[model samples]
Target: MGKNIDDYIDKGLKGTPETKPSERREYLSQLRERIILALTNGQVIQQKPYKPISDLMKRYPSSKLYLDGDLDYMHLSKYIRIANENNIPFTIVDDKASSTNIGLVLANPTAIDKDDIFVSREEFQRHL
Candidate 1:
């Protein structure tokens, strides 16, 4: 049985002819061209719009809002604007001590501290 298996493997290996250098090169060139064409004419991917945290707050009014320390400024600004407009209170807490500029927007008048700078929705609109 071992001898028969060995003969079968040898027959299978010998049946396929090795590709010539020129033929191999031409085949590779064609594959490269196809890949380049596919890449150049590829479909344009569309990104979904960013959903602000304030939108979520509107849906769930009592939900606690916690912004990540590493979030993009533009995205954060959108949430801040929405929160400010709707009088939704939000706290920006950073677990990392290195992040000194953690933003905290308080809509509730009672929660305001002496040191905290108060900015009304009208002021935010004027700046915009």
Candidate 2:
């Protein structure tokens, strides 16, 4: 059909379409619904790791950790250590093409539709 041909041509010309490109950029290439936890660059840079993150990793052992490759490894290493301790797979997303304020994300491959994925600074501090 003409529409099918157009679709194929479009795909060839523009590459495959991505869902919620902006959201993915903001969440370090993961969908919002799939994220179990997200931390801002500032949060990740704190001297201590967010306390609940370790527990969350234990709760969702199958989840993957996405760290912003833009930051130095020292800023990200605490969480990386936790991921290693929990056996949660981790990735450093070096998305030079896009800029994001989010420095870390813990997410599943499938959508979890979690409503409270971001931890407020107050809650994070209290947990620490």
Candidate 3:
């Protein structure tokens, strides 16, 4: 894998795919789009070149989802499904409360709640 974006940007991460701020946002935006489209279509959304986020969501219930740190869809989907499976609960703060600070939060991974499965990032990013 390429170096994480943060690593190259400022020695903050430890992975490949070093991405510029705008690049990461744009890439994440694209992913968020794919996920929402898949969910609406009731089809499986594949995170091409990476893990599939939809696959994991399909396995969970709807709770136990939380958006805190930056997370890719592939990983968030798993976290959501697991929460649903375990009946755990979480929530996604408003985009205003997001750490991305881009006026747009792409969920890298989003938060989930018992009654509300945060469709914010995917849902919101969809139209963007």
Question: Which candidate achieves the best TM-score against the true structure?
Answer: 2
lDDT of 3 by residue, 51-112 (tens): 23434444543412334334445534644554455554544333323244322122223333
Q: Give the alpha carbon lDDT tens digit for every residue of 14-110 in model 2.
A: 9999999999999999999999999999999998999888888888878999999999999999999999999999999999999998999999888
Checking candidate 1 for backbone clashes, the offending pairs are none
Best by lDDT: 2
Model 2 lDDT-worst window of ten: 119-128
Off by over 4 Å in 2: none
Clash count for each candidate, listed in order shown: 0, 0, 21
lDDT computed for candidate 2? 0.93
Alpha-carbon TM-score of each model against the true structure: 0.30, 0.90, 0.23
Worst 10 residues of 3 by lDDT: 35-44
Ranking by lDDT: 2, 1, 3
- Cα lDDT, all candidates: 0.37, 0.93, 0.35
How many clashes in candidate 2?
A: 0
Order the numbered candidates by TM-score, best leading: 2, 1, 3
